[model samples]
Target: MTYRLPSLNSLRAFEAAARHLSFKTAASELGVTAGAVSQQVKKLEGSLGVTLFRRLPNGLLLTPQGEAYLPPVTKVFEDLTEATEAIAPAINSRKFRVGMSRTVKQMLPANWPDHDVGLRNHIRDRIET
Candidate 1:
């Protein structure tokens, strides 16, 4: 059977909402309006054809479907983050120095011979030694 994935933004919203059990709090965390969070969650529900939350006067409650779905969703994000972090360059590595040098070259004036030569020599020295 084929399964269609919901929008990433919507899934993010739902994940945050599920974590907090509050759409308003989720919106605050996501830097969007509460209405936006609600809309995204609604869209996600529509896509999944499942009622994930039970809206109440005080706050939201997770449905059985939501309760069951939360762990896997959380795990997927956690796994993705762990995988990305595992493959990422070390913080103390020299990769960032080269990247910064490249950025400086891109932003500096092309006709300034002295500045350009000095910067190039500095970067080459760093790379060589």
Candidate 2:
């Protein structure tokens, strides 16, 4: 089944801003500039058709709709964190095995070029393209 959802970044901005009631604080926590957080929250508000925060000179205040919205959004993020943590150990324990063709293996370099700048440049050029 398909479901409509706003952008994850917007939801994250909304949640962070609502929690701290300050765009600057949310921006710090999210590793972005205050303007970026503000823009993200604005985008979220536009998508939801509601003003999520009442902007103030000093700080911010969540509107009634934002207050109601905060709990579910926060819960979803917490649940996602828990789910990731739960699966991390099993994920870490898994091993990957690569099988290559004999011809491809034969073509592989035996050792990295230690003193050959020309060979190094040639390999670098091939990888970059």
Candidate 3:
């Protein structure tokens, strides 16, 4: 069976709001307006067909469903960020040596010198593989 997911942006907004329990706080953290954050959260709630938050006079409160859902969502986002950073070139700047056969090394230019060769090669290798 295939499961459908909602928009990532909506999920992010909901996660932020759930963590803070305030639409205004979530908006501030996300750098968007409170209305936008509320709209995103609303969209997420609608997509999930569950009431995730209870609007209160003071602020917002997480419903039982939201409380139950928050940890997994937070973990998923954290894991995604960690995974992306793990493979990100900007994060992994250490030198990586590739042991190629003589024939493969011969295919590369011997005396070619470029200031951006490492960056270009890294990008090319990422795209190819």
Candidate whose lDDT is highest: 2
Report the error of model 1 at residue 79, Å: 0.6
lDDT for each residue of candidate 2 in 1-129, tens digit (9 for 90 to 100): 897899999999999999999999999999999999999999999999999999999899989999999999999999998898798856544443445676775677764343477755544221210
State each model's CA lDDT, in order.
0.84, 0.85, 0.84
Task: Put down candidate 1 lDDT per residue, 37-88, tens digits, no spaces.
Answer: 9999999999899999999998999999999999999998989877877898
Clashing pairs in 3: none
lDDT score, candidate 2, position 82: 81
RMSD of each: 10.9, 12.6, 13.2
Per-residue lDDT, model 3, residue 83, is 93
Query: What TM-score would each prediction reach against the true structure?
Result: 0.65, 0.68, 0.67
Model 1 lowest lDDT segment of ten:
91-100
lDDT of 3 by residue, 43-127 (tens): 9999989999999999999999999989999999999989988889476655555566667756877642233667566542321
lDDT of 3: 0.84
Point out the higher-scoring one by lDDT: 1 or 2.
Answer: 2
Query: Backbone clashes per model, in order?
Result: 0, 0, 0
Candidate 2: residue pairs that collide:
none
Better of 1 and 3 by TM-score: 3
